[model samples]
Target: MSATRPTLKLTHSGALQALDGALRKAEELGVPQNITVVDEGGNLLAYVRMDGAKLLSRETSMSKAITASSHRQPTSRLDPRNEIKLAIAGGGRLTNLEGGLPIIIDGHCVGAIGVGSGTGEQDVEVARAGLAAIGAEDQKP
Candidate 1:
């Protein structure tokens, strides 16, 4: 058998820091939002919904987080047509929104953050704050 390879992963403490950062930004913007943080494997690591945030944003935030992690890039990279196709036929595995950002550390994608319930720009801003808290590079659109 071949030797096992090591890989990076986001820790619970890191996820908490990301969540706190996102919430702080949302508060500064005075916009309630739902935020999701996912691991490199596209699994949820942390999530939160501010009071008064639209309930509908919950799933969208999660989807955005998963899409970013799975693609190892921001969701904004997807074209509108592709976004529609993926939403309708690709099992919602992707999104074409600006609120999702990959968490890159040491040139590697360790996770992602997605924020919803505000304008795309606002959401992305919040997500960027989250990434920054973890000392991850921002992958803004």
Candidate 2:
């Protein structure tokens, strides 16, 4: 077996594009948001805290992005029963919130986007917009 394998990575420009899309969506919804983007390894790529967004949500948004990237799935899909455990295990870096979405491209998860400072549904909607902007697959229903 080969020791090295090819992997898709999220570019800084792509991360910025996703952030812009999420910001536009938040503006359209009249909800300022704290948005974050992270690479597949859960390393931060981009972030934005829109004017009027909840200051405390900045950390939550990053947590959501990191959780999505690490889990390779939407944060909303995580087992609620294990929410506390997951958070503890991640040292508060993981969350079971609805704002996080994995950025899937060509069947691979490249990264993730997360939005906070809005209702769960609204946050997901914004994140979906980000995925759309980057031509990534949105979370399945």
lDDT of 2: 0.93
RMSD of each: 1.6, 0.8
Overall lDDT per candidate, in order of appearance: 0.89, 0.93
lDDT of 1 by residue, 1-141 (tens): 869967888998899999999999999999999999999988888999999999989988988888888888888997776677778775875777778899999988988898999999899999999998889997658
Tens-place lDDT digits, model 2, residues 24-124: 99999999999999999999999999999999999999999999999999888888899999899999899988899999999999999989999999999
Model 1 scores worst on lDDT over the 10 consecutive residues at: 89-98
List pairs with backbone clashes in candidate 2.
none
| TM-scores, all models, native as reference | 0.93, 0.97
Off by over 4 Å in 1: 1-3
Cα-based lDDT at residue 136, candidate 2: 98
* Candidate 2 ranges with C-alpha deviation above 4 Å: none
